[model samples]
Target: MQGLIISALIAIGVIVLLGMTIRIVPQRNVYVVERLGKYRTSLEAGMHILMPFIDKVAYKHSLKEIVRDVPRQSCITKDNIEVSIDGVMYLQVIDPKSASYGVDDYVMAAQQLAQTTLRSVIGKIDLDKTFEERSEINMEVVQAVDEAAQPWGVKVLRYEVADINLPASIKDAMEKQVRAERERRAVVAESEGDRQAAINRSEGDRQAAINRSEGEKQEMINISEGEKMKQINEAEGRARQIELIAQATATGLREVATAVKEDGGEEAVSLRIAEQYVSAFEKLAKESTTLLLPSNLSDVGGTVAGLQKVLKTIDRTQP
Candidate 1:
């Protein structure tokens, strides 16, 4: 009976010991084992054997990516503008042993570090840069957190600044600045167009003035040329008239000399000369209103005697 009791007790003790030594770790999970209050080894997924009273499972962590939202925290920008920023971070445990011993609480440490680093980085940049460059801020936060968490066996894969909060006054000011800039550009463009138009109009006016002046100059030149031609014609007509008068005077003198040299009797010549003079006077009277009178009536006898001598000479020369 005692042997039966001892066997039953041994079986119960074996079962309890087996329970203490054996551990079932689920997939995507890690267990940090500690022996005698010190880190011994890390156990992965599947069955693991742990020495009773010698080795203990200290911490269990999931290897899968974990995401948490960082709460909004006030930060001061480089330009001394106060802002509130919030973001999310993705992290995973790499070494379970280090994760258990390297840090007290990885999640709390990461959250606080992320907030501090976010403020520090944002404080180094202006408000405009902070508002415009969210991705850069996110990357800076991720890098800082990853570097700090490296010793804790935690890998910070990525982080993102989801939203930023700004003062109403700043938002209004930015909007006004944009509107003013657009208006200024519009005014400049309009002024430039006006200036160009004025230049074109001035050029056109100058060209028109030049054309009018040229036309006036051409007209004056034509008038001067016409006057010159008219003057030339007048001079040529006066020269022709002088030449005709000289020719007629020479012919008249030659006829008078021929008549005198001929041996026509003076009385006969005087009668002929009188008749020729009357004919010329009658011709002049028909063409003009002015009358020509003899300068001396007593000289008429001398003129008749001279003509008779001229006729006699002409008659003698006929032989």
Candidate 2:
């Protein structure tokens, strides 16, 4: 019974020894070893052996990137505007020994430094710039925090400004100003459209008036040309009729003069004169019921002889 208890006690001691000496570090993890309360070595991934009860794990650090959110804090700008600011920070531990011995807590130090740096940067610019230049603010904060965190083996990758809140009164004022600007632009655009439309209408009216004038001028010219042709044709027709009448009268007079020069022309003229005188009496009797007889109406031969004598007298006078 004493031998069995000694064996079991020895086995239990071996197990405890193995547990203290051997260590299996996870991926992307580091274990810092201490000897006599001083840093001895740093353990990487996989299995590591240590001096039992002399060498122990002191600090554990993660090599992976870590993110921490910056708490919201009230900040004053250069323009004396109060705003609430919050952000996030990306960090990585580069050296485990420095991360352990350089600062009490690297993450807490980096985060606190980031908050103070953000306040300082925000106080330098105007409130409007804080909203517009967020990326610049973030970059400034990252640079400042990273530089100060170098001694703590904490590398700051980047910082981002999450939100910047403005007061309600300022928001309302900005909204009113934007609405007024939009209204002014709309009014100007409408005026420009009206001006353009009026110009188009005036141009159309001017063109229509010009076309009407051209048409009226063309119509006047056509009417004047037609009148001119009509007057010319009428004048030509009157001239043709007058010429024909004058020619016919001249031909009849020539025929009468030629007949007068022929033989028996005097006797024929006398007989024709007597017949015309009798015919004139007959025409007057038919027009009226009363007839005026000559004093020697039954002496026809005497009248005929008297006309012959008058014809002989006219013949003797001719050349």
Every candidate's lDDT: 0.87, 0.90
Model 1: lDDT of residue 162: 85
Supply every candidate's count of residue pairs whose N, Cα or C atoms clash at under 3 angstroms.
20, 0
Q: How well does model 2 score by local distance difference test?
A: 0.90
Q: Give one digit per residue, the lDDT tens place, for model 1 in 87-120.
A: 9999999988778889999988999999999999
Provide the TM-score for each candidate, comma-separated.
0.54, 0.64
Note each model's CA RMSD in angstroms: 9.0, 8.6
Question: Candidate 1: where are CA atoms >4 Å away?
Answer: 1-17, 185-319
Query: Which predicted model would earn the best TM-score?
Result: 2
Give per-residue CA lDDT, model 2, range 114-165, as digits (tens).
9999999999999778878998999999999999999999899999998888
Best lDDT goes to which candidate? 2
